[model samples]
Target: MPSLNVSFSDEEMEGVRAAAAAEGKSLKQYLHDLGVREMHRKRFVAGATAWADKLRGEFDEAFPEEIPPAQRGDGAAAA
Candidate 1:
C-alpha cells in the first residue's frame, strides 16, 4: 500500500487522537475507516441517483399524465 503524509495543527491532532481513542481505534485505523466509508457513501449516492433517474424516465414514458386517472383508485373512471 502507498503511504500518505498529512499535516495537522497540534490542536487538530489532539482532537483526532481523542476521537480515535473514544472509538477504540488507532488514529491510522480511524482515518482508514473514515476514508473507506466516505468512498462507499459517494458511490452509493451516485448509483442511487442514476437508478432513480432511469426509473423516473421509464415512469414518465409510461404515464405522461402523472399516473393516469384509472389507476388512481378514485373509481371515477371504473366504468
Candidate 2:
C-alpha cells in the first residue's frame, strides 16, 4: 500500500502506543485496524439510516401500539 506522512501529538502517540501494546501489534498495525474499523462504521451508519427511513413505517403496522383495533388497519382512529 502507498504510505502517507501523518502527525500526532505526544498524548495521541502515547495512547496509540498503549493500544498497540495491549493488542500485541506495532503502532502502525494498530492504527491501521482502527482506521479500517472507523471506515466500516461510517458505511454501516449511512446504510442503516437510509434503510431506517424507508422501512420504519412498516414496523408500526406489524407491532401496533397505543391504538384501538379500528385504528390499527389504516392508521386512522375510532371516533
Candidate 3:
C-alpha cells in the first residue's frame, strides 16, 4: 500500500488524536476508514443515478404521449 505524509498544527493533531481515541482506533486507522467510507458513498450514488436514468427511459418509452412535468406550460411543475 502507498503511504501518505500529512502535516498538521499541534492543536489540529491533538484534536485528531482525541477523535481517534474516542473511536477506539489509531490515528492511521481512523483516517483510512474515512477514505474507505467516502469511496463507498461515491460508488453507491453512481449506481443509484444510473438505475434512475434507466428507469426513466423505460417510463418514457411506455408512456410515449406523456409530457414531462418540466415541459408543461400550465405551471403544474415548479422550476
Among all candidates shown, the one with the greatest TM-score: 2
Question: Which tens-of-lDDT digit does each residue in 1-79 have in candidate 1?
Answer: 8978889999999999999999999999998888999999999999998998779878888878786455778756753
For each candidate, the alpha-carbon lDDT, in order, equals 0.88, 0.83, 0.91
The candidates, ranked best first by TM-score, are: 2, 1, 3
* Top candidate, metric lDDT: 3
Worst 10 residues of 3 by lDDT: 70-79
Clashing pairs in 3: none
TM-score of each: 0.67, 0.69, 0.61
Clashing pairs in 2: none
| Candidate 3 deviant stretches above 4 angstroms | 57-79
Q: What lDDT would candidate 3 get against the real structure? A: 0.91
Q: Model 2 segments beyond 4 Å from truth?
A: 64-79
Tens digit of per-residue lDDT, candidate 2, span 2-30 = 88677999998898899999999998888
Compared with the true structure, what per-residue lDDT tens digits does model 3 show for residues 1-79?
8989999999999999999999999999998997899999999999998998879988899999988777878666554
Give residue 73's lDDT in candidate 2 (0 to 100). Answer: 70
Q: Is candidate 2 or candidate 3 better by lDDT?
A: 3
